[model samples]
Target: MSNTTVKRGEGILSRNRGVLVAFGIIGTWAISLIVLLLIDISQLAIGWRIAATIWQTFLYTGLFITAHDAMHGAIAPSNPKLNQRIGSFALLVYALFDYKKMMRTHWLHHQQPASEVDPDFHNGKFKNFFAWYGYFMFRYWSWVRLFGLMAIYNIISLVLKVPEVNLNWFWVAPAIASSLQLFFFGTYLPHREPEGGYVNENRAQSSNWSVFWSFVTCYHFGYHEEHHEQPNVPWWRLPELHQRKLNAD
Candidate 1:
């Protein structure tokens, strides 16, 4: 397609799709939390609980990615304040991530990817994935906040008659899994050395695989170069942008 065609298509996208999708993801996330709370985990078999927990963990990743889009101003491009508020709340819900702190770190990550300034950078600190992961948590972890979250959940379960197992299966486990997903797929795989890229050293790269696998890997965050170039595109739309680039080439 021609530039005009691309522009027109992007213009249409620039309208309500971002915010609408944001709301939709928010709705799904809210519903998932409610269901997890209401569902009595003790009644289900251990196998079923495990399966359900994994499925819910995937959904939690989606919620976090929606918030990630908002951080990039992909959602509600015309209404930044709205996007900011939504992003903050979305991060808040997903493992109680502090939006402002994340924003600062993320911006730095973009500005100096894989460099010392990038908060996520892990050069010389750890040798392997497990080691790096431990350090990553060390820099950003807040035990006080985590304990408070657990306390609140315990109270909520008492008042609402929700199962503790459900909290473990749905909330706690999923949040932990979500962290691994975000770290492994979104950060580690995309930004690691050699295969992963840096600004001056090696530089991050995108998946050459089909967009399906790319998104499957990490909500199209596997398209790391594309994302770094155009941070404003939502995760759902990264495939389109990648395709458009291919067509232009």
Candidate 2:
């Protein structure tokens, strides 16, 4: 979307469509969670467990990404209260995130991306992934969330003896992996400064790729500029926005 599009109200999404898309993404995520609950990865071969764990991480991140959309009002544009509720629920489901805390910084990120004030972006401050990731966790880490999840795992696994829960494999492992996926694909790639003399605040990975790959990369979030431009558009519509950008180019 462009300035004209925003002014013309073309960027405002259909609430019905937004609600449906929200539920659809949430449904897919729920299915993956149920599958994890049903299967005892403990009995599976080590290789299978690893593969399942990776898949689970992707699903976990999907929920968080959806919540990000909700933060921008893309998930329920016609209803602010509904959008906030959905965003809160999505973040709560995703690693016990605080919706208001995240929204405060995230909106700031949109306002001043790649700048010193951008809470999420490390810019060039950290020399490497390890340094940057460590800083990210430090800034956003929640000790109450940490203990809460630990308590849940212990209660379910130790107290109840639910082998299928496998809290370490099913919960902790995926959340850990999801942190890497979300940070690298969503924050680092898009917000990094573009090449010299080309002044663009946001970058993308949404070229001639299938929607599957686009979503696979980062819930179609790789189209960072389009996302910021049309904050009202949901992740599912980002590729269409990206395609329009390509055609216009």
Candidate 3:
């Protein structure tokens, strides 16, 4: 396919795909969280509640994945202002994260990857899972964010009279679980040192999982190598590029 053909194809697909998907994910996440918080958990069976938690966790991860796409400017290629505004909104909804801070750090992760300079890396000292995860949390956590979330929780609970049980299970638990899901699949699995060492400039590895599992894991972010190579491809289109890479190899 010529560049002209590819660009034309992308133009058709890109018209409103990213904007729609971004809003869809955000809308779903917000609705689900609200419903879960207000629903009568006592009426639901244990298994059903667990399923709801898992579903919400997936949506929370989707929030971050949407923001990640926006960080790459994949969400709106032609409109910088709209692109970043969406990115900022996604990050705020995700966890009150600072989009500018995260965008800068993410570019560093792409630029230096597994090196010490990378903010997402293990910092060379905390190589184990728990330690590294703690380090990762420490790097991004802020008192302001903490207080902001706490205030939100209190306002919903004390002012709105929502049960703390629902808040804990649906809102807080899913957000924390989503972070673990993202880090374990997207960061640790793809970037950890393989026995043979990294084989490319991106200093990343792609998971050999099937496409379904890859998407389930972290929005195809487990295909980290392809992402580093083609950063402009949106999350929904990663599997296509991954398949192309596999066929060439």
Deviation in Å, model 2, residue 179 alpha carbon? 1.2
How many steric clashes does model 1 contain? Answer: 5
User: What is the Å distance of residue 44 in model 2 from its true position?
Assistant: 2.0
CA lDDT of 106 in candidate 1? Answer: 84
Clashing pairs in 3: none
Candidate 2: which pairs clash? none
RMSD of each: 4.5, 6.3, 3.9
* Model 3 spans with C-alpha error above 4 angstroms: 1-14
- For residues 117-226, what per-residue lDDT tens digits would candidate 2 score against the true structure? 87776746684677877877888887999898778777877776766346678777888899898888777767665566225654333335577887887788777778
TM-score per model over all chains:
0.86, 0.85, 0.94
Candidates 1 and 2 compared: the better one by lDDT is 1
> lDDT of each structure?
0.80, 0.77, 0.91
Better of 1 and 3 by lDDT: 3
| Cα error, candidate 2, residue 185 (Å) | 0.8
Candidate 2 TM-score over all chains jointly: 0.85
lDDT of 3 by residue, 1-249 (tens): 899999998888769799989999999998998898889999989999999999999999999999999999999888989999999998997889999999999999999999999888898987888888899899888999999999999999999999999999999999999999999988888888889988999899998889999888889999889999999899989899889999998
